[model samples]
Target: MGALDIFCYTLWILGSVTAFPFGDTLNRQAVLKTNIQTTAQFPNNTWLENIAVRANGQLLVTTIVPDAAVYQVDPTQSHEPLLVAKFPSALACFGIVELGLDEFIVTTNNWTLSTAASPPGSNSAWKIDMTTFSESSGQGAVITKVADISTATYLNGMTVLDKTAGTVLMGDATLGVIFYLDTYSGEYEVVLDDVLMKITVPGPVKLGINGVRLLGDELYFTNNNQGLFVKVPIEKDGTAKGPYEIVARFDTILDDFAFDTTGNSYVTTDPDNTVDFVTQKGSVTTVLGNKNSTLVAGATSAAFGRTFEDEGILYIPTNGGLAGPVNGTFIEGGKVMAFDTSVVA
Candidate 1:
């Protein structure tokens, strides 16, 4: 909350996380891995909003409504899901990001963004420490509320940044702004905001900036309702260095995205029921989904695999089938899906 230099924490690049070389090598094939009806966990009104991949090949999925459960899916195992932790049926779960080896930060909604006894719909972020998490021991991730973020309008997507101190950058889907969170002090600061982030086409889903990621000094985010993807370079202190750059515009609802070693972006188109393979050149290509009932619709988030069994693979989770069908109506439970890049490689 003070000067950026006072809180600036060193940004760590774990493994090859931010080391990719952007290009054609990322425009690979996308194959459907699984849908909710076919999955072993979450077969109800669980809206799997976001996902984070464990280096061991397991995935942590955060749900949206009905049931606030975090299920762990292991492809290397029998593919059966393990219960990591379930939140109160009242609280809301949205997007998640890996903080460290077994630590993570999760974005939430429903509560007022104030510290007083207000109402729901106000958003916030949380920290899940899994250093000692173990299901066999009847123990799991230790969850804690990140202080001071009660003022967030609609905390949606998140990206970790040590901008002077331990922090995570969060995007408010409704406010069209990104806030820098001080993980240690519990304070936050709005680091970026622009007209491009405001929901110009307020529709049934008027979300502004849905997903965000930082590569070097560049910040990438989705203007959901506007169907636009944008990026901008920021100074070391988290100030914008230049104007917003248009990455691409799509015909469908662009929800969230993930980056691969080639710097190619894999984006999910919500109601369109598809994922787009976006190259660094700002070209859009369909890699998964078909707007059908089977593949995966309502895709709210994406992340690349971190384990050997899943490395280079793009992992995705859906908002069940609650987002409405393009041609008809149906009930789809929250589920996890993935794309195997080996065939394209």
Candidate 2:
């Protein structure tokens, strides 16, 4: 071959190797062994909604019970949450995360029993002291408000970015935007908007952004109705680059997600109903399913916690199945279930 031809061939090979997609090749699997023995049920008064872990390993959970209470469940015994605070009745707690050693924040929706398409409450977020369980209302804890956006509605999912001065990033499902809220100052700004594409399914497919997780420089989110998981690139300038790509697709409603230190992302699906764990490479395996009729109802959200003394376990909450007799309840008596990830294959 001529010298110029050989050089061109080398450049082609190099470019091909550099541009090869590496994320799709990884195999993700979540082998869920049903552990009926380890199940921890929450009290009837408290309907567990979402859960978060503190730096010290204590679990902070939000509930739908009266008094806007945030419960702290011992890592060892998650069934019984130690009641931390009983704030005002107006606070309709949705998701929660710890801000510091003795403080935390919780998100609220409108105080309504119906799941109608309505805007989330404009009530400012509240900051609570973990030590005294004292809450400061009115913009102290609100990172962002619906008023901040001319037409914003619901704030569904939230997670704390510890590296960013403890700022919390929240998903507003109603308007398809992600807001970055300053926990310390209550100032908020839109970091991501129109990032998720609406699922064009006929007859009300649950197609809005639900759960979000940050893995390295990439942000992953769930499209609940379409059962799709997507990954977006995070630029150095604190913005995300998209043409957002779908990583995995399942047959259920994807709700919430949590990642272990090993980069395995666990997802909870409702309606069609199942729980799955996906690896960083976009492969999925079912951890919990209705195959054996084991999970009495559809799984809503899940969080990982320490079991016994130091082993890791998963805590899942169920929204009773549609065909079952106990339908239409947010979380009934048989709502909470636990699995020991250390023992599951």
Candidate 3:
């Protein structure tokens, strides 16, 4: 068989042998009494990967499968989503982060889902300027290619390390390293590499150090293979200042996460169809969805609403288990889900 066929065969073998555990083994319940609601829904097979909230309270969602594009969704109104931009050459758009007031940075990849493979020199980054963008006016934002990071494989999640310096850190899942990129000059380098960031599982499905974020001087990341959410002290330039510390552990894999004002994190468990709440002190609980709940099924990434009216609500974008469906059978169209955090237990 050919290379693509061989790769597909390998994935099929892994899928048959691997046992991805679901459910709350710790008996964790809803930490917050969340009023979950579907804010926006995409077509079936749309793999919504990551999310970022615009200053005006709209959410920018990145789609990896079916189409490699960025969509703008206004949570206040359940209307149709507005197309922000599309990457025709790439097969998927993976991560997004707000760099400036209304400007954002995004990562795109040329990987195929069926074959589970990506061609070399197919990874790149872009900038989307939405300062003067308006949904009704039909005015499109300025799209710019910032850097071509072909050296790093599978750039999944991103977080701004130093906004003033225009520096951002992107997690390279396959390479088990973080690429430090300067958005202005398009210069990039491998900033952080450690065993903690390496993948423990053998297959291509489970990734290592998939989600990354920076708060103050601490760097936080999640490894899907190891099922670990960890944090470490880091410099402004993306260098680790201290050793990595384990924040929490999970049986299922983690995709991406968003931090609230109070330092709590709402993380997405892809196959488990759940959004986990991780407190600053490392308290882990299932605050929304579960192995059976469709509210946030196939949840991939999350972000909190920017406006004061919805600041307490955590906005989650789900793939509806596009890659790994709930119970290995249930799947739905990718959609944006909102969990009101103000309604506490």
lDDT, residue 170, candidate 1:
85
Error of 1 at 266 (Å): 0.2
TM-score of each: 0.83, 0.74, 0.89
Candidate 2 lDDT, 152-244, residue by residue in tens: 466667766553476777776556667777766667777876545344455565447778766655667786555677767665333676556
lDDT of each: 0.68, 0.57, 0.81
Residue range 178-200, candidate 1, lDDT tens digits: 88887777778898989878888
- Candidate with top TM-score is 3
The true-versus-predicted C-alpha distance at residue 9 of model 3, in Å, is 47
Clashing pairs in 2: 28-283, 125-142
Which 10 residues in a row give candidate 2 its minimum summed lDDT? Answer: 12-21
Candidate 2 is scored at a TM of: 0.74
In terms of lDDT, the poorest run of 10 residues in model 3 is: 12-21
The parts of candidate 2 lying over 4 Å away from their true place are 1-32, 36-39, 43-46, 65-68, 87-91, 116-123, 132-151, 162-164, 195-199, 236-238, 291-296, 306-308, 320-331
For model 3, residues 65-113, the per-residue Cα lDDT tens digits are 8878999998987457998999998999999998887899999988777
